[model samples]
Target: MAANDFYKTPSDAVTAVNSIYFLLNAGSNAVQTPYNTLFNTGMNFMGDDENPGPGATNPDVRSQSVLGHASTGLRVLQIWQQHYSGIKKANIAIEKIPGIDFGANTKLRERLIGEAKFLRALYYFNLVRLYGGVPLILKDLSTLEEAHSKPRRNTVQEVYAQIEKDLIEASTVLDPIAGGADAGRATAGAAKALLAKVYLTQRKWENAILKANEVITGPYGYNLVQNYAEVFLPIYKNGPEHIFSAQFKSVSQGQGNNQAPRSVLTGVPGIVGSYADQVVFYSVPDATKPGGVDKFFSVYKLYSKKDKRRDVTFVTKFKSPTNGNWYGRLNDPAIPGDSVPFFNKYWDPANVSNLAESGANVPIIRFSEVLLILAEAENELNGPTGIAYTNINKVRRRAGLDDLTEGLSQHQFRDSLYLERRLEFVFEYQRWFDLIRERDAAGNGILESSLHKVGKTNASAKHYLFPIPQQEIDLNPNLEQNPGWL
Candidate 1:
């Protein structure tokens, strides 16, 4: 059947859009996909909050951890390929689905197209952030000539303009609530929330606040989950707080959440796990240690004991099921000898037999982030107005923390909000983006400074945007590399 002939009915349109979603998280045959452990690990390693564990011996992975990855790096190439693959799938659906005849179900056709637009926007958003500017391929190319003719990278402003256009159109057509089996699909609120984030990234303060406010007050019914831990629980997937999340299920091969296995520590009896990554901790010089080794510092020490989010975010110790003995203490000060904390958000207790069978969904966007966006944008424009304080306090109150000081300058509030984002979203593939986008009072790039604070001195201004993959540039000579990469 011809490609155009296949989309003659609503079922055909649905199937096409479904493939895009599959590529977004779970590629065919258990392959690594965007938002999966392999991709998130690369992002996490680049941030200050995570480090490649001892078991992660991949040179590509280690290169990113030390900010030494080049344009030829495998991790960089994989990220570029997977996201564009998703974009291609999205383009086919967006172009073909509109021609399908839905008869009485016209809304279904529109909804499918909206989903495709939302996904395409998301792919471009990530691409622009990582590569500064990327090829803005919207329509499906019919021939190799068409493909090769338009390989030039668009301007960063042009890419963002397309992202905003897609999200705006998607916001109009998508349902406010994706309920029943459609729980993980993009909703109207999700589109607005993501748009708010895009605006925030561009430093468009008023626009960001407007989009965030639409999500907050719009009939989406999004709110912070009363229990901080319940937000990531598998049973509570697509709960009130989740605006959109990448769906995962453990019943089939290639469908489980791989983040769980990678984050879990190995050598724990009865648990087959690989500690491919762990939370970052500070270190101090110790003269008495052999080889003058530095003592370990626990990242969890930054969290207050009373903060309910601390226990839910990091695992300091766990009881071994095989021997019934606790391996480490809760909140042990890692002076020199203490277990390193692993991420707890994706750890699934039910999938102990095979950590790869964990079914927890990776959140793409949720309500709490929208609140933070509103707070950050409002403060940027209005300087910590009552509206900003109220939204920020909502998250703080949930974490069992006191409100912000009675009066704070815009700088103080901005610093506090950034810290809250680091703590609230650890290991969720957010820290790296925040590190790159955030600016200091002097308007200088902060990625190098932030990495320097965490003992990674290799980061420079060029580290803000990853190099465009060398393989890509080789394939299309017109695809120029980002500055400092060549």
Candidate 2:
């Protein structure tokens, strides 16, 4: 079954596009996929909101947490490998699908190509952000000679230009909404929403506002779920609020969400779990302190007690099913009790006996984020207008908080929006990106400053872009390493 022969039929075109989604969502195993624990640990461990928990003793994981990961680090290599793998698959589909004649069903052919382009844009988006100037491989390589002649890294601007082009085309061809079995696939709304995020990242305020506004007022009908907690629950998977997500299912060997086990505390008498690899608070028992430990700046502490998002985002206590007794509390003396809060956002209650089998879709873009994007871009372009206030208030109100203080300066408004994004999207893997993108008064990215405030002194300007994997450089002399890595 050659690819050219296999792609001649409509069913084959569908299968070809499906493979791209499969690779993006569920790889060969749980550890290899982007949305799983391993990928998150590699990509986001340096964020102020996350730290390597007691059980995270692997040096590769620790190196990232401390912002000292080298070019040879395993996690860095895996991130590079996984994203390029996805990009290659997308390239194949994008090239082959258009050639297949769908007869009367031209829409299907158009949709498949749209999906491939959207996914390719997303893969390159991740690459360009993390590694900077990755090779813009848009076509499928056919020969061993072509594969051996590795392409040189394109400029970051070039990569972004390609991303914008693909997404613009995708948004036009994709359906406004995906329904029935087509759920979880990319839609026009997702493309527009992601493009808006890219624009916001690039500081193109006007374009960001225009694209985000389209998703908000467009025919997509996306909105925030009534209850904040329901957004991550399996029952609400692909709900109206979710513009796009990496799909997962329970008890499906490699398809389950691995974050459930990675974030859950191990040795719980009643619940099956694993080492809490990433935690909001990293602390230990100290008999000298009142709470038996010196309390540091936990990301959870940033949320006011009145904010509903706090309880939904973290679990301070859990009842043991073994004895029907609650065994955890905030500031509890017992270690692993409630002294440290576990991420509750992705914990699947259905997989109480096997956390690894939990079914939870990892949200890539949600309606709430779009609202915040609108607020941020609007403030940047036009100061805090009524539209900006209204959009930011929508998210704040959902968190059960009052409207933002009136008549704040642009600086004050931007600061507030930054905090709002952090609290709104903890453990969803947005913190690191936000930290790197948002700048401080000094004109430097807040990533280094924010990490330093949290006692991560190793963070520096060089950390803004990760080193290209040494393995990659070894294989291809054309692939140059990022600055400061040498």
Clashing residue pairs in candidate 2 are none
**Against the hidden reference, what TM-scores do the models get?**
0.95, 0.94
In model 2, how large is the Cα lDDT of residue 292?
78
Candidate 2 lDDT over residue span 79-127, tens digit each: 8888888888889888888888889999989988999999999989988
lDDT tens digits by residue: candidate 1, 285-393: 6576454654455456568889899989987666676888666532345344565777888877788657677888888889999999999999999999999999999
Which 10 residues in a row give candidate 2 its minimum summed lDDT? 329-338
Global Cα RMSD, each model: 2.7, 2.8
